[model samples]
Target chain A: MSRKPIHRLPAWALRTNGAVVLLFLYAPIILLVIFSFSASRIPGQWGGFTAEWYATLFDDSRLQRTIAVSVRVALVSTLLATVLGTMSALALERFKFRGRRVFDALLYLPIIIPDVTMAVMMLMFFSQSFSLLESLFGIGLSKGFATIVVSHVAFNIAFVSVVVRARIAGMDATLEQAASDLYASRWQAFRFVTLPLIAPGVLGGALLAVTLSLDDVVVTQFVAGPGSTTLPVYVFSLIRKGVTPTINAVSVIMLVASLILVAGSVGLQRANASRGRQQLRTSGGNS
Target chain B: MAEAKRERTERRRGFLLALPSFAYMVLFFAIPLIIVLVYSFATRTSTGSTSLSDWNFDAYRKLGEPIVRNVVVRSVILALVTTVICLVVAYPFAWFCAHQRQTVRNVLLVAVMIPFWTNFLVRNYAWRILLSEGGPISSFTEAIGLGETDILFTKLAVVIGLVYAYLPFMILPLYASIDRLDRRLVEAGRDLYGSGPQTFRRVVLPLTMPGIIAGSILVFVPSMGAYVTPELLGGGKETLLGSYIVTQFLTARNWPVGASLSFVLMAVMLVSTVVYFRSGGKNL
Candidate 1:
C-alpha cells in the first residue's frame, strides 16, 4: 500500500512561509543596524563609512543623563517588583483562599490594559489628590522617579506572578515533603527546597520586569516629571526634531545590552531546566 | 506541639509575604483607577483642579461627537487588521516551529523574542527610515524602475508597524498551543479516511483556537491603543485613540476630554476582552 505524501506538503509549506515570516520580523531591525554606520547625514545617503554617530552619542550629555535615569528606574523597579512579585506568586500558588480568581484577575489587569490608560489614570490620581496623599503620607505623590517605580511595579507584578506560579505548579512537592520529614523547620524547608526551585522563575520574571521598565515610554511619559526623562522618551523627542545618526547609535547600544540580558536569562533557564530534569532522573533511579 | 507552632508560623509568614504586593496594588493600581472613575464625572476647575459638585454624563455624552466616534471606529478597525495579519503570518510560522526538532524550535523561539528586547521607539524609527522616500526600500524600488514615492506617512505603514511590533505576542501563544497538540489526533483522522485539509479543519483548528484567541487578544488590544508606531510611521497625519488622548493631556491640556477618551477606550477594550474570554473560556 502506498500512502499519499500529505505530510511532505505541510513540511514544505511551513519552511517557505516560515522564512518569509522571519524576514518580515527582522528586516526593520537589520535596516536600523545598517543605517547606524552608513556615515551619511541623510538616512538613505551612502557617503562612505564613519564612526561619527557613535562618537556624537558619547558626547551628548543629555542623552547620557537620560540613559542614567532609565537605568536607575529599571534597577529600582526590578528590585521592588521581583520581591513583591515572588511573594505574591508564593501566596497565590501555595494557598487557596476566597476571591482567589478575582485577585488573580486583578493582578493581571495591568498587563492586559494599554500602558497609556494606566499612565493617564495614574496622572489623574497623583495630580488631583496631591493634598490627600500629602496629608496621609507627609510626601506629595506627584511625577518623578517614585511614581515611575510604582507604575513599573504595578505592571510587573502580573508577569512575575504568572511566571513564578508556573514554576511552582511544575515543581515537585516531594522535595519540600522530604525536607520537612527530615526535621527541617517550615521556613527551612521553603528556604532550601521551594526557594531554590522557584529562583529561576523569579529571576526570569525580574529580567522581564527590568527590560519593560527600561523600554517603557507611555506610562513613564505620564508619570515621569521634569527631571525624570528616560532614554526612550529622549529618543522620541530626538526623532520629532529630526532623524540623527546619534539616535541610531543609541538604538544599537540598547539592542546590544538587551540581547546580552536575554541571552543570559535564556541560558540560565535552560541550565536550570536541565539540572531539574537530571535531579528527577537520579531520584527516579535511586528509588 | 512543634507541628502546631510550625503551622502557625507558616500562616503568619504567608500573610507577611503577601502584604507588600497587596499594599502596593491597593495604593497604586486600585486607587488610580478609582480616581479615573471619579474624574469621569467631576468638573475641571479653572485652576485645573477637579471639582466633584456636578456629577453628570457630560464626558460620556461628549463621546458621541464625530471626532471621538471616528477615532474609536478607526482604532478598532486598525486593531482588527493588525490582529488578522498577525494571526495569518504567525500561525504558519508557529506550526513550523512546533514541528521542528527541539534545537531548531529553541533557536527560532529565541530569534522571535530577540526583537522584543530592543527599544520599541528605536524599532519604530527604523521603520521610518526603511519606508521613507530616500530609504533603502524606496531606493530599491527606484533602482528596479519603480518611481520614487514616500510610503512612510501612509496608513499602510502604520498597519505594518503595528503588525511587526505585536507579531511576537501572536506567535508565542500559537506555539504554546500547537506544541501541546497531540500528533496522534492527526494520524487518527487520516485513519478514518479524512483528508489532510479536512483533518486540520476538523481536528487541529479546533484544538488550536484557544491559542489563536489568546494571541489575538494579546495583539489586538495593545495595537488598538498603540501610539508610538502610528505616530512615528503615520507622521502624525492620522491619529489613533492613544495618540489622541496623549495629545489631549500633554499638548491640548484638556483634562476632561482626555480622561473621558481614556475611559471610553478602556470600556471598549474591557467589553471586547469580556466577550472574547466568555466565548473562548473553555479552550483558554
Candidate 2:
C-alpha cells in the first residue's frame, strides 16, 4: 500500500526467481504434452502432429491391464482406507483415553516412515506369512493384486486419518451435543449429524488416498505379483526398457489428470474457507 | 451409578470406533516393522538366503563392508546435495508465494503442487526424455554454446531429477512457516534500520528454522532412500541406497543385508526427525 521501499527491489528478484523455478517445474511436462502429439517415433524430434500415441495407449493390452489393476487397487484401498481412517479420526478426535497420545503417534508412523522401508517390511512379512499359510493351511496369497491393495490400504489409512482428523479437530462440538439434546441417541447423532458435517473431510481424505495409492511405486514393486503390475510400476518397467513417445503420451495424460485434481482441490478449499467466513460473519451479526 | 455407566459407554464407544484401524495397523504396519527388525539380525548364508537360525549382528556388521559403506556414503551425499538445492531454490519461491495476496497465493500453491501430484515416474520419465540426446534441454545447452551433454544416465542427472522431484516437499513447509510469520516482527526488524539481508539473517532465518529443518528432513530422508528417480535417471550405473537395498533383496537374495540397510536408513530419518521435533518442529 505504501510506496515501494528499498527492500522491495529484491522482492522483484524473488518473484523472478520464483517464476523461473515454476517454469522449470512445468517446462518438462509441457514438453511432454507437446511431444505426445508428435508423429515421430523418437521423443526428441518433432514430426507432424498426430494422435497416434493416444491410439497406441488404448491398444496396448499390457498398459491397459496395468491401468485396470491400478484402478482396482486404488478403488478398493481408498474405500477401505476412508472407512478405517474416518473411524480412527473420530475416535482420536472425539474421545480421550490414557494412551490417546501414544495411539495417535502410532497411527502417524506410516506417514512419517519412508515408503521404501514400509514397502520392504510389508514385502518380507507377506512373503513369510504366505509361506507359513502355504505350509499350514494350504492357501497361498501371491504378491500381486491382493498384496498391493492391502499394502496400499495399510499406508493410505494413515494419510486419510491425518486429513480427516484435522478437519474434525476444527469442527464445532456443540452441534453433536445439540443433536443429543434433541433426544437423538449417540449413535444416531453421529450417523445423522456428525457424518454429514464431516462428509467433505471424508471425501477429501478419500481423494488423497486415491492419489497416494495411484502414485505408489516402491511398495507396489516389492509386493507386485505376476500379472498384477500397477501403472506406475509398468511405467518404471517401460522407462527401464527404454523410453519412447508412448511414455510421453502417458505422461501427458497423467499431467492433465493431476492438474485437474489440483485445480479441484484448490477450488474446494476456497469454497470451504468462504463458507466458514460466512458462518463467522452470520454468528457475529447475530451476537 | 449413572456416572459410571456413562463413562463405560463412552469408553466402549471409543474402543469400537477405533478397533478396525488399530487392528489393521498392528497387523500390517507394526508387525511387518518388527519382522523387518528381526530379519535384520538373521544370518545370510553363502547362498544369499537368510537363515532365521543363528541370528546375530552379522548383517549390521556387514554394513561396514566397502560396497555397502560406499553406497551409504553416496546416498547420503546425494541426499544432502539434493536437500541443499531444494532448500535454496524453494526458499525464494516459498517466500514469494507467502507474500502474495490470498487468491494469488492459492493459485501459486496449487501450481507448485500440480507437478508433485503428477505421477512421480511420469515426471522423472519426462526429465529423462528432456535430458536425452536431441531433447529440449540438450538443444538449449548446445545452442548456448555449452556443447552437447550426455547426462541422461549419470549422477548429475540423478541429482537434477531429485531436486525437481522433491522441491515441492521443501517449498510447502517453508510456505507454511512463512505464512504464519507475524508481519510486525519483520517490521520491527526493519525499523531497527538493519538491511534486508541483515534482518533476514537475524530475524527471519531463526523464525523459519523449523520449516527449514522439516523441509530438509522431508526431502533428505526420501532422497536418501529414493527409488523411482535414481532408478529412472541413474540408469543403474551408480548404486544408490534405494537400488542397492532392492538389489540385496530381489536380485542378490540377501534379505539380511537389505533389512540392515533399511533399518539404518530409517534410523537416520528417525534421528533427524526427532532432532527436528526437539528443536520446535512440533506441527508435524
lDDT of 2 by residue, B1-284 (tens): 99988888888888888888888988998899999999999998887777898879999999899988999999999999999999988988898898889889988988888787787777888888889888888888989999988898899999999999999999999999988888788888888887777778888889999999999999999999898888888999877898898988889999998998999988988899899989998866
**When superposed on Cα atoms, how far off is each prediction in RMSD?**
2.5, 1.9
TM-score of each: 0.94, 0.96
Interface alpha-carbon RMSD, every candidate: 2.2, 1.9
Fnat of candidate 2 is 0.70
Model 1 clash pairs are none
Fnat per candidate, as a fraction, reads 0.59, 0.70
Tens-digit lDDT track of model 1 for A1-287: 85553344556677888898888878878878888888888875566788788988878888899999999999998998888888889988876544456667778778778888998988877786687768888885557888888788889987888888888989888888999899998789989889988999998998988888877888988888999888888888778778877777888888777777888778977898799889889989999
- DockQ, all models: 0.60, 0.67
lDDT of 1 at A84: 88
* Per-model lDDT: 0.83, 0.87
Top candidate (TM-score): 2
Q: What digit string (tens of lDDT, one per residue) describes model 2 on residues A1-287?
A: 55243244466798789889989999988888888899988887789999989988988999989988988999999999999999999999997655667678778788878888988899999989999999999997677788898999999999999989888988999999999899998889989989988887888888888888888988999999988999888888887998888888887877676666666666667778898999999999999
Question: Model 2 residue B265 lDDT?
Answer: 84
With candidate 1 superimposed using the best TM-score fit, by how many Å does residue B165's alpha carbon deviate from the native? 0.3
